[model samples]
Each structure stands twice: as structure tokens, then as C-alpha cells.
Target: MTFEDTWKPKIDAYRAKLDEEVGPYKALVEGIDYSSENFNAVEALDTLLTEKDREITNSTAKQLVAKQRDGTLTAVEIYNAFAKRGAIAHIFTNCAMELFFQEGLERAKELDKYREDHNGELVGPFHGLPISLKELMKYGGKVTTAGFVCYLDNYISNSPREESVSIQILRKLGAVFYMRTAQPQSVMHLDTDNAITGRTSNPFNRKISPGGSSGGESAAVAMGSSVFGIGSDIGGSIRVPAAFCGLYGIRPTTKRVSGLGSLSGGAGQESIFSSQGPLTRTIDDLEYYMVNYINMGKPWEYDPNTIPLEWKTGVSLPETVTYGILLTDTLVEPSDAIKRGLAYVQDKLRDYKGKKVDVKVITIDHDLMKEAFKQTLQIYGTSKPVHDKLFAISNEPLLPLTKFFLGFANPEENDILTNNNIKEQFKYYMYYLFKDQGIDFLISPTNPNVGEVPKNLTHWNYSSMFNLIDFPNIIFRTGLTFDPKVDVKGPTNVTDYNANDYVNAPINLQLTALRFEDEKLVEGVKLLDKALELA
Candidate 1:
């Protein structure tokens, strides 16, 4: 049978399941036209949202929680507003793999009742806040296909004890799960396209991708349907989508947040283990979720793999914060838009009065970076066998990006032990650079291009390099957008340059720190954001 003939029925079955799961809420976006060369989901949502829906969805998670605690807003009110917006967003961007609005509403009501019975006291830190989830995570009673068509009917347990510790923690802290976002076919690509949901488009620009495998979470948050969402990153999954969607996201050091029940191929591959973190509209929310999740949730008790380290809420910045900036990863040169953003940040730091800032333009060891990049691919490819087995079950054809990834996942790859040894050497080399220079943080571009052109993103050198070394990194917008005429590509080695493709795509950068220094990294980026006047 041809690929289409074999996979068509499976795709139809999955879509039917999604429609059944969403129920009546599916009708909210039934008549909308989502096909267009140039479409903005956020703007399209603007026309659909009511005045109240606009106000509720516009507020940050912090703001919503504050209001809920103050008795000004009810959990049910917040859920309803987001339900409408999330449903609309799913239609416009194909962001949701499943929507359980009714289930979410029922939980919201329970929370509201709990607060009322407790004499107006709050439930927890994240009281009444709704968090969209990446489909890979194990949610009780939900089918977590992890983007494979074969697992559509497979259901997780309905018990909280069976869920991911991160999910368990969030529930304890009062988080509502209304929707699960889509991901790429293999959950290995840097763009979102699966046989089940087709593709998740950029909220800012429909023609381009939001980013993958957490691309749907980024799109859902960017579209204002979710204030914050959980996403996982092994390679560039979390940070790339956040940068592409103009949001704040973190790829915390591995085992910081429990990866206990998260679903993905390469499950036991430790050469580059995945880290789960929150992606949000504001930088404060990034820290807000992490601090509470670690300190309040205490994930280590549930997941033995989790580190028992506490996240320090208040990290004091040093008198002088030294930043090391890299223009290129020496693999793929950053586009003109990203270069301008780095320059803008450099200029801001040079003139800032908030703190004593020392900025240095440092060149990374190109050879070392190349070695790390090579190792990351080998480590990632080790899971190709797992993916091959899953795809064979449904006879599902590989998506464009998955096929590209399998190209690197060579069958003749070196053993995992060799890769880990090389990874250790690479980590020490990076650590020595930080120590030798006394650099507080390493700032670099989030992606080679400012915005992703769907199915065209081929480089992960910048973001994935951090994954290779197990460093925690946070993505923050540069408060700049691509200006086609002004940010035109100058004479360079990039052969396929198009200024028009990156229209209005925000330029963002990654702020990284040494391994297990996630708290300090968040604090340092907070300081930098203030200095640059970026909210």
C-alpha cells in the first residue's frame, strides 16, 4: 500500500477522536477559514473574543492568581474565558491535540467550592490558573500518543497517582488542564506537524511554524488562549518555540523538574536527557512557575529521578554581571534580524545605569561546538529504532522533519557510552570557559533565523548546544521585530536569504548559565530584562 493509503484511515480515526473529545466546543471554530498565505491567529482571535474574554485572557497568570486570591475572580470565570479562546486558537493554529473543556470546567467549579468552604482562603500558589500541556506528558485517563498515530486509543489511568509528578505537583498547586497541544510526528523535529493534527502554525504568522515539538504549547500561549503552558526540551523544543512565538520559556537543567511521566521516544537515552519547563508570556511567570513547582510542589518525593534541590526564589545579582555574547555558533550564521537584536542588547548593556555591567564579545571554540553538535545528533538518533517501531505499527509515513532527523539518526552510529564520554568532556570545556572568564551568563541567538519558515528549519546549533552540556537556559524577547527593509541580509555566506519570510517575527535571545544554576539564570535574566526595558 502507498503511504497515504495506509495512514489515511488512522488520521481520520484520530481526528474523530479529537472531535469527540472536544465535544460541543468543536463547533466554536467550525466555520472559520484557517487557510491563507498571510494570517495572524492573534489578530483573528481579537475579532472573536468578547470584551470580558479579552480582559481575562489578556491578564498574566500572576495577575489572574492575584485576583482569584483577592476574591475578585472565580475559577469558573477564568476557565470559561480561556475555553472559548483556546477552542478558537485550536481552529486557527491547529494547536490542540485534545480539548477537555467540560472536564476543566468541572474542576474549576470544585476549586471555587473549595475556596468558598475554606472561608475565602486560596487553594495554592497557582490557584485557578489553567495550564495547557504538551501531549507527550502522561495525564490520567488521556491518550498520550506523543504524536504517533498508533496510540490514539491508548488511555492513561484516571488516577492522579498515575500521572507525571510535574502534573501531580501542578494539580496540588491548583492548575487546571483544559487542553493538550499538538507536536511533530516523531516528537523529534523542530517544527510541529503530525499525522493527527496536520501542523501548528505560528500565532504571529500563519505561513511560518510556531516551532516544535512544543510548538503547539507556544502557539496556544502566544494566541492568548493560555497564559502559561508546560513544554519539554531535549534539543531546542522549548526555547525555539518560545523565541519563534515571542514568549518567555525555560529549558531547566535535567531532573530539576520531574520527567517521571512525560512521554517521548529515547526514553532511557541519557546522553542528552529532556528537561521540562514552563513557557509564558512574561518573564516573571517563568520564574513564578519554577519556584513554586520546586519549593512548594517538592517533586523529588514522587519521582526518585528528580533532584532534591530547592529553587531559590530570591537570587541576588552580583555587583557586576559579566555577559559573554556569541554572534554565531560557527555552524549556521544568525540572520540579519537576530544580529540586530544582539547588537541592540549589547548597546543597551553598554549604556545601562541599573547595574555595573561588563559585556564581552566572545568567540566560542568552533571545533568544540561542532563536536557537541555532532554528539547531540548521535544521542538523538539512538531513539530512531523506537520511532521506527511506533511508526511501523500504524504504517505511518514519516513527516518531512522526522525524515530529515532520521537522516542524522544513522543506524551505524557509535555506542551511547562513547557519546556520553564526549558529552562530559564538552561540558567541562564549557565550564572552564565560564570559570576562566568569570562570565555570569552566556547570551546567544535562539535560532539561526528570526522566524521559522515551515518545514525549512535545519539548524539547532545555538539552542541544542546548551542541551548537550546540560545547562539551563531562558529565552527572552529582545523587544525588537524583523523590519524587512531595514534588516535586509547583507553580503554573507547564507545562500537562501529572504527578508520577506520573517515579517514581524520577534527577535529573541537565550540567556544561559552553568549546570544546575537555573535559579541564578532566571534571576540574572530578570535583571537583564529590566536593564533593557523589556517587560
Candidate 2:
């Protein structure tokens, strides 16, 4: 009577047939040495971050290009170091789905030759930056199965004659994506767990889950695998992993970037929301990407769906800015670390900046926001129980966690209409949230728990609530993470918002703006990003 009861046998047969042919791949995967890989990977990483931080942070891409012009370092050497680290990262975290190292090296060599020919001068700003990609993105001649069981043999990515639009744009800006990272089955989970590459682990701790479907990108960037990475989001796909892995990421407004030609599991589901953005080490790197990925790529030219808006670099903040502080959404009270982390951030913004920053605490109608967000994620919403049941069929072991999703009834007995109505409420709540707060942006925790145990999933409503509002939100670490002893404190709420279920996690802070007011949100986060020194 369960979802798997009818389809498990069919899906398992398909997986067996595919595995039968991919003998060596299946064999190589069985015995991976994670500890050795993680240890060596982290040791090598410290040096690269140190070098890149000094070179890129001060004057940024503009300065790096200037330094290249002055002959300090060649593009080839930078590309080589990052590529090697990225390879090690794949082994350490199960972060890679496919690779093109040789291809990227060859391109790097060409850039070296170009600089040599001109005595140093070259192309665009990000001429030598190393970037990795999520598997859902298509690059010509790379498989784009995107973790589906049936499409394991799909060669859409291997069609050399056709490259994805994003790939073309990156190449034009002199960016090279030498590898593709992993994703989950439906491309919906906040953690990676698919049939092909399996689940990816957190870079900080291998036992913990990195938020997904963009988890691999966040993990890679966190472990110093790549300088920056591009990932897609719908819900908190970009922010969750960024928060979970302790990195900076932006989920730009849905229409800001190109999602065209990208491989996705649920292609047509857009009512809730979907977007593509960056998971990077530094907020400045994020700016570099947004500026170049917009101005130079000319995404509007390729995808009609993309808004014909260009990056407005000249936009300036007022002499002072006030942030609408949303300490807790009141949906689920954040863990002690989250509360402390936000307080720390609020304090730093006051003392560190010293002057010229105006801050305010704005309480939002939490009951409405929480109720609205909860309604949006019901059984038959964008993430329908039926589709979940279908995807779960491919589950040979039922994923343990998903069994709870099937509910305690036969598939035929589940309520469908009641579910969709809740999903619709998410849209209704957004209309009220912005009207309630006339401030610049809302700040709140991404998850009540920093990083959860592997299969013990609980929170998503924090950011999912914002997703309901269709706000442009981003996540980055404050360099402070979970230390349960220091972070733990008694519950604040006398009722349901009690402290018993909470535990410290690297708290994620969300900066949100009104619909299409992404520029304002980005500016506000950049200030906090600088103050927090998350880079």
C-alpha cells in the first residue's frame, strides 16, 4: 500500500540493468577512503585560500587583472593550482559528477600563450578564475543526466555540437568549468542523494550533510576545491548549502540569470520559485560573478526568459542604511547558536563599522509568514507526494527518511486537494509580508539547526517562507559555527517554541528584499558580509 509497494520492483530492475553495464564505475565507488582524502585536502587548501585572499580581496578582479598585466603571475599557474585542488576535493567529498581537467588545462595554456604574445595583456576580468559547475548545468560533450536513474545512459551533455548557454557565456569571459558536481534524485532535496554519484558530505565534517541540490558546489568551494562555483536554487538550494558548508552564496531574483538549457528534474514547476546563482568563498567574488555574468554574458540575448536588465554597478547606498531586523520568523525558533550568531552580527555592524550605519529591529508578523510558508510545501505542491512516490520507486532501500514521506497510509488514501490548497497559501502570505514591513531588507536565520544529522531532516520553513514571498535572498557564514556547549541556552518561548528540540548549528543569516529589489538586498548583504568578514 506504500508508494514503493507498486513501483519499487520496476525501478530496481532498471538500476540493475544500468549497473550491470557500468561495471568498473560501480566497483571503484564501493571502497572510498574519506579520512585520508579529507585530511590531505584540507592541508592543501589552507595555502590556496591564503594566496587567493591576498590577491583577490583588496582591489578584486580589476586588480588581479592589473597584476597579471604587471606580470606578477600567469593565468596558467593559477588555473593549475585550482584544478588540482578541485580533483582532490572530488575524492574527499564525493562532490564531482563529471570532469574535464584536460580540456580546462588546454584552455589555460592558450590564455598563457595569449599573454605571452601580447607581453601580458589579455581578455576579460575573470580571465584566469577557476569555476566549477553543478551537474544540472549542460556543457557540450558532458553527460547531463542530472542524477536520474533512467537517464544514467543519457548523452545530452556529450553532444559536442551543442553547448549550454551558460557554458558559452563562461567561456567568453575566459572562465573554465573543468568539472561538474553532484545532485539529488528529484533535484529537490536540501542534500545530495541520487542514484549516480550518491550523497556529498560537508567539507568541515564528512559525517554531516551539505545542503543540496547545490550541496556539491558549496562543499567544493568550502574545502577550497574551486575558487567559486555556480549553482541553481528554488527554495534554499543555494543558501542552505552555503549556510551548511560555511560559505557565501547568493540566490538572485528568479529572472536575473539564465536557467535555459539547464537539466532539471521538475522542469515546469515555477509557481513556488527557481533561480541560478553563485556559491563562492568571498562576497567580492560573488560581485565579480554577478557583474561579469551579467554585463559581459548578455544573458538576455541568449534566453528571452531572462530580464533585459544589466548589472547596475553605479548603484550606490544612501550615506546610511537601516536594516529591518527579523530575529526569528517565529515559525520555528532558531537554536541558541543562531540567536547568538544574529546578535553577534547585529553588534558587529554597530561597533565594527563605528559610524555611518543605521540599524533597526523590526518585528514581523511571524504567525502569518510561518503559516503561509508551511502551506506552500504541502503534499501536492511543487514537490508533490505523487512525484515523490514516483522518485522513491528508484529507491532500492526506500532512503529511510522518505518512508516517512509516504505517510502512514496507502498511496490511494493520501489527500491531494487538501495539499495543493496549502501550497497556494504561500503565495497569499508573500503579498502580506512586504506590505507589513516597509524597511530595506529582512534578516533572519536560514535554519534553526546549523547542520543536521545525515538522515534526520527537520527545518526548511525558515528560508522556504521567503521563497513563498519570491524574495531575493542570500546566505553566508559569519565565520562562527556550532559549538553546542557555548551556544546552548534555555528556551525563550513558553509554549510550542520551546528549547528542547534545538541544537547549535552554524547559523545562517538571510537578507531579503522586495520582489525584483535584488540590488538593494545585495548591497545590504555586502555590508554585513564585509563587517562579518565572512571571506
TM-score of each: 0.95, 0.81
Task: Name the runs in model 1 displaced over 4 angstroms.
Answer: 1-7, 17-34, 159-161, 411-413, 490-495
Report residue 211 deviation for candidate 1 (angstroms).
0.6
Candidate 1 RMSD to the real structure: 2.2
What's the CA error at residue 347 for candidate 2, in Å?
2.1
Worst 10 residues of 1 by lDDT: 490-499
CA lDDT for candidate 2: 0.66
Model 2: per-residue Cα lDDT over 1-535, one tens digit each: 3426644454466445433433433333345445632233344445434465434433345555666678886677676667656665666677877766767788888877887887677766677767788888877665576766545445664442355677778877877667778877667677777755567877666656788778889878876656678898876888888888877788887778987878765567555557888887767778778888988888888888899898888666666666666777676676677788788878877875533775577665666665455455542144455446556545434454334333423445335454445455655655455455545666778766665554654456777766655678878567676665676552332233323233323466777777777666677777787777753
Q: What C-alpha lDDT, on a 0 to 100 scale, does residue 425 get in candidate 2?
A: 63
Q: In model 2, how large is the Cα lDDT of residue 506?
A: 48
Q: lDDT values of the candidates?
A: 0.85, 0.66
Best by lDDT: 1
- Badly placed stretches (over 4 Å) of model 2 are 1-44, 47-64, 117-121, 157-162, 379-398, 401-438, 489-506, 533-535
By summed lDDT, which 10 consecutive residues of candidate 2 come out lowest?
493-502
